[model samples]
Target: MTCSATTRVALWATLLACLLNSGCTGTRYIPSQGQLASPTPPPQALKGFDGNARVELNLPGGYASPDDRAYPTQRANEDIQNWFADSGDDLTVAVRNENIKDSGWLSMLPYILTLGILPTWLTTEGETVMEVKSGDEVLFQNREPVAYRSALSMLLPSAYLLGSPGTGQYQVMADDQLNRHKQALQQYIQSQQKDYETAVSAGTVQAYRQYLQDNPESFFRMETLRRLSELAPATHALPFHRDNVALDNAYIVYLPDEYDIWFLGPQDMKVYDVLRLSREEDETLLASRIRAANQPYKVFNGDEIALLKEGGLSPGLIAAMIDASANPTSVKPAAVAPTVTSATSGAASPGTPSPAEVTAQPGMADIAAQCAKRYAAMKACDQVPSFGANVCRSQVKKKYSHIACELIQ
Candidate 1:
């Protein structure tokens, strides 16, 4: 038996490749890299939390068999600990138990013998208990199980290039399982916290109210109410005789005048009356009630009047509103102009007021024009439709009617 020169060379090369591959290959529990390096933990990935909780892994020996046999040499402990290094102080995660099993070093021999063609598999199955706590209070506890299947071949030099053989894949699987536990723990904490801190952190009445609405029985209910009162005391002072306290609370915040009409006591009416009558009441009825109530009229400023008009008060009702105001000069009626004009043009009639004596007031036409402008802006009625002028007038009138702007008449 004689061997060719080429065959001898090939055998030597094959032997060298085997040695290199064996040195680089690793099982799921054992990392292929000679030097074990910890990973930088991911950023704050938990929702509704600042990731201010400290995380700890109690798997002291790192990897272990199902029967309590530990693999103290494995870097799983350092890798997991480093992964959660900066996670936060709000939560502490303790690993109570972990088990990892994988095919040993000899498993890679078959892969090396087959050159780059054949592949060997590494499978790991384990169970871990992760316990979450918040300052001596346990928030969540759960058992997580992991099963990972991977293949090793010489075709890819990822292990050699990364300075680790099968460690990357195994680490990924372990991290994935830990992440799931973290997520579950996060959900549990959120349910317990009920976004109370998030709302408080915002420090706004709207945020506090929203928190109350979302979680009526929130742990921080008293604190939320205190904040709400500080931010907007009116919401708390509003007389709420209704069963739905939340709805009544909103009434004061959004419709204080309407709230007065419906909920004010007879004693309160004298002091807090808005004098803006019910929508169902006619101007005549409103005037009669205003006179009978004998309460000081409620005078609204320009901004208040604009808001009232936008709220769908009719022009006639607005005129009645002006009449109901304590400041009689707020809106001078056009009827007063006739007396002033007569006095100015002719000799000064007895008991007739002069132009200077009569304060200048917004006339009906001026009020009508102002209302029209507001209506146009509020409804975009000035913009003719793509359909052209044929439907423009009707559409404009329809919009005016929708906003109860009687300026068209």
Candidate 2:
């Protein structure tokens, strides 16, 4: 070979070797695109939790029937646990054994040679879901995908060979998800400044209707609707539904506070009628909850609920009371002996305060209104739904995503 040709070959070999070795030890990457550069955290309205919160994690399933999964569910579980370990002081996270096909992915690479110039379209996507419950009621749920990206490298193009499939990206996504959940929780507490009681006390059917409309994604939607119907069974007879992906089974109806929330089904059916139709075993349980909250004119508050629970009152019973107090006219009188016992064994104990609805503190309303403006901006933009997905590849994608403000969920 000519001297110059030998020199060129040596240079190519050395460059390739460096690329292969450096790939494994590159500085960790933090993605800047498709995220809120300065997202105003969501508004929340809630009393400080009385005790530590419990979180339950549901594992991810395979996207396709790959006997060998790309992102194993257990690994995702570990990711979540490690995340909470840092920020979750008064919170506990546990796993639910059931699995789901949590996410899917796609890529583009017309020519292998292009891998050198462009990302070889290596993406691994998976969704992680966790739920928090206060008693039987799910306070909220969160599900978000952690997408992994790795460019094609001639030395180790196949991610499996490296045994580290997008590890850094996975960590970033997991941290982001945890932060979002924490923000949502704070916003929830803020929202309570305008609780069902506030909506009910406002007394307009419009108020009830507006509450549901403004918070279509709220966890308390179904129960809120049920309360509205009770306050004005005939006036608020209109049926409403939510369009959000997470709230498929939710709806509103006029049922007595005594009705078992779990007992809902076959819409338009009265509570007593449904109760009569339930299975023998379920019927007994339903009956017990109903009897505890059976008062025709009583509101149930959660704090007072712990006292009643030992007496067999279900957590859902407290939900019914919160709903009842929403009515401006639903008077909260002193707890009477006959009512207490009737509600639970009908034996009254004096000095037990009636379930009192707390008045709204200030500032929460302002937070909610601001979030509304943010939501409006996102809906009006023309770009793709997310930067991570890169739904639109137009020259104007960046400009439009900026208009979007924040991811809509």
Best by TM-score: 1
lDDT of 1 at 285: 70
For model 2, state the Cα shift of residue 404 in Å: 58
Q: Residue 98 deviation, candidate 1, in Å?
A: 2.8
In model 2, the number of clashes is 16
In model 2, what lDDT does residue 398 have?
28
Writing each residue's lDDT as its tens digit, candidate 1 over 167-190 gives 454455455545656566556546
User: Model 2, range 142-231, lDDT digits (tens) per residue?
Assistant: 655444344333334343332344344334444455555556565664575367567657766567667766665443554455455555
Name the lDDT value of residue 171 in candidate 1: 53
lDDT of 1 at 27: 33
Q: Over 4 Å off in model 2, which ranges?
A: 1-33, 36-121, 134-137, 152-168, 196-409
Backbone clashes in each candidate structure, one number apiece? 7, 16
Instruction: Give lDDT for model 2.
Output: 0.35
lDDT: worst 10-residue window of model 1? 381-390
